[model samples]
Target: MPAPAISFEFFPPQTLAASFRLWDTVQALAPLGPRFVSVTYGAGGTTRDLTREAVATLHKSSGLPVAAHLTCVDATREETLQIARDFAAAGVTDIVALRGDPPKGSSGFVPHPDGFASSVDLIAGLREAGDFNIRVGAYPDTHPEAADSGADVAYLKRKFDAGASEALTQFFFEAETFFRFRDACEKAGIDKPIIPGILPIENWKGAARFARNCGTRIPDWVTDAFEKAERDGREDLLATAICTELCSELIDGGVDALHFYTLNRPELTRDVCHALGVTPKADLKNVA
Candidate 1:
């Protein structure tokens, strides 16, 4: 079977220097011809304006489809709906609806009493706001705050039932975990696309810490590979190899499309896409 198409995720820049880096990343990966790239909103909606601005820039300048992530952590229903309308008017039809994280230094997530209580609610709101292509977050290993894996799957199903066009999972290290999650979604009657979120091993220590916080497993072999490279200064080469192997294995396991968590870096994603034989569309010749 042929390799699947791919998408990518990028965060909005917090400063001018970061903005330049983000544009560089976009230029590098646009040649891969991702189905769409998503710009993440800040936790607790702190960077809502910045996120919208960045998404709009991508839409205007990149000539590639862009999805703006909208979260319901701190905004009122009216506020969230208004932002959705703004995106629609700005020629952005794809929305990644999410229940965002709590404010920094907070203990846990606390929902807005009159707003969405979860991602499912946010999906429903987006659907009502417009005829947008909505996406929601998923977790193969169960969300950290969920009661259990079964409950987490059920929640993801609810998001689909509410009209989400697809779900992008949290990054996972093991393909078996994704296969099991797909099985669960299939069994639950979720027919929408469930794309696996792939995170390349660029910074092993940082990635490991994040995986632990998000409940994604960190395989020993993955760590061992990075550990061996600690003395060689070949982390970039190793990152390329590890991510390529992971994606190749996933394709062999029947995955068609991937959503890469680019972490604002593109070389790794670019290399992996090359390895997978995904070429940029001809009209986009200047993307690189």
Candidate 2:
């Protein structure tokens, strides 16, 4: 099969050391020629300025297409749209529009009095405010706040109708999960591109917790394997193998694109991409 089109997700750094790490990550993965790389916002839009700075710096320095994550969490409607307009002014036009998580201690998402209430609303506002290639989130498994898997599909359709250009799914363990979700989306009359998100397990404990928090079901076998791998001190080896296998399976199943949630770490993601025949181009740009 042809090498699939690939993208990556990164987060803005909050500290000087973290800034170095983020640049290192970009340096490592940029050579792989990702179609685009996205920078994420912190919960409740806590890293709004950082995300904007990182997106701008990467756009200017790295010669890579960078997408900024904009959320309806703590900002007003005008505040949010102005950010999008600023990104456009900087020559960055791709956005991942989201209804972000509530603040660290909050019960759940509560829209700001003057903010866009939902991701769909945010997408609509972005559409009206600027010319952007907007991406929205999708849930292969049921979203934690959603009524069911079907509800997730219905909500995604609404996001598309509101003007999103694509959907990037929450990471899941099995290819079957994505296939089922794709079938459901098709049945629901949603015709947009849905790219599967892959998280190469960098930390078992953290990944498990994140999976639970996001309503992604972890298979018992995955837990058992990680347990054994940990005992044997082969966690990295196991992680690479598992991630490569998963990507191979998805390609075999006819998936033509993938988005990796790199979590600001590039080793495992780079290894997995190489294993899938995504190699560095000869003329890799200097990210320094």
Candidate 3:
């Protein structure tokens, strides 16, 4: 099979030490020649400014296209559109539009009085604001808030109809999970590229918690394997093998692109990409 095209996702740093980690992450993965890299916003859009700064800086200095995460959470419509305009002015035209999570201690998402109320609305506004290549989230398992998996698929179709050009699924534990979701999406008449998101398990505990929060189903076998691996001090080795295997399966199943949620750490992601035959190319020397 031909090597799959890839991208990486990083979140904006919250501290000086985190800044170092983010840069080191870039240095390690940029050489892999990702088609684009995205920076995420913190919950409730708390890291809006930081995301903007990181996106612009990376676009200018890294020789890689950057996608900024734009959320409709706490900001007004005018404020959010202005941010989109600012990103376009900074040479960024790709956006991952989302209806972000509620702030800590909040019950659920509550849009500001003057804000776009949903991700569909956010995508429409971003479309009006600029010529952006918009991306949106998809749920392989039913979204925590959805009535069922079918509802999630229908809502994803609405997001595309609203203006998004692509959908990136939430990370799941099994390749079958993504394949079923892909088939469902096709049946629902959504034809956009649905990139599978891969999260290399660096900390099994943390990943399990994340899966719960995001409504991703984790197989019992995976939990058992991680438990055994942890007991044997083989966490990293097991992680690399599982992630590389998952990518290989996806490629074999006809997926042409993959997105890695690096969580601001790159070693496992780098190794997984290398195992997939995405060898470092000389073009990255310019970015270095």
Highest lDDT scorer:
2
1-288 in candidate 1: lDDT tens per residue? 476799999999999999999999999898778889999987778889999999999999998899999998887899899999999899998999988888889999898988888888888878887899999999998778888899988998888899998899999887888999999889999889899999986788899998888888777988887998977998999988878877888899889999999999987888888888887667645558
Cα RMSD for predicted model 3? 1.6
lDDT of candidates 1 onward, in order = 0.89, 0.95, 0.94
| Lowest summed lDDT window (length 10), candidate 2 | 279-288
**Candidate 3 ranges beyond 4 A from true positions:** 284-288
Model 1 worst lDDT run, 10 consecutive residues: 278-287
Query: For residues 1-288, what per-residue lDDT tens digits would candidate 2 score against the true structure?
Result: 688899999999999999999999999999899999999999989999999999999999999999999999999999999999999999999999999999999999999999999999999999998899999999999999999999999999999999999999999998899999999999999999999999999999999999999999999999999999999999999999988888888899889999999999999999999999999988835544
Pairs with steric clashes in candidate 2? none
- Residue pairs with colliding backbones in model 1 are none
Task: Give the per-residue lDDT digits (tens) of candidate 3, residues 142-251.
Answer: 89999999999999999999999999889998899999999999999989999999999989999999999999998999999999999999999999999999999999
TM-score, structure 3 vs. true: 0.98
**Candidate 1 regions with alpha-carbon error over 4 angstroms:** 284-288
